[model samples]
Target: MAATEQEESLDDLPPSAKLVFKVLEYNGPLTQKGIAEETMLSARTVRYALERLEGISLVTEDVYFADARQNLYQLTEPAEEFTASDGEEATCAD
Candidate 1:
């Protein structure tokens, strides 16, 4: 899909998911606990947001080397460009 199309798709995501995405975009990769703390969102809410972001191919998850039990989440390459090229943070209207 084109960049514009993917961005449009992001617009359709829930506010929680959009907030999660913005957090990852600015903070770099983070584990679920980190995301929950940063966003002050419940663990279940963070997990749900991560799932939605993952489903849309905006976020990628990988093993967290520091803690084997946890996984790290970050923006996918294409998703990174969506923000980097624009030089602005995507707004999340909740």
Candidate 2:
């Protein structure tokens, strides 16, 4: 999709959700702990954002290879398309 269109799609997301998206984009797949650390969000906050993102079909989680206790998350195609937009540089809250 075009960048502008992508940005528009992201317009409904809350700031926390946007932050999770950016972290996933920059770091590739990440565990919950990694996301919390990278985004400087509390673990509970990250979980909440991930759940919200997943509800929108924007993010997905999978089992981590080395650690069964952890799940790695990454952006779905739609999310990548959204973040690629040019109207604004997406920012994640620290």
Question: On residues 60-93, what C-alpha lDDT tens digit does candidate 1 reach at each position?
Answer: 9999999999999999887553464567776645
Off by over 4 Å in 2: 1-9, 79-94
Q: Top lDDT: which candidate number? A: 1
Sliding window of 10 residues with minimal summed lDDT for model 2: 1-10
lDDT by residue for model 2 over 1-94, one digit each (tens)? 5664455445587898899998898889999999999999988999998987887678888999989999989988755445647777666556
> TM-score of model 1 relative to the true fold?
0.75
TM-score of each: 0.75, 0.71
Clashes of each: 0, 0
Off by over 4 Å in 1: 1-8, 79-94
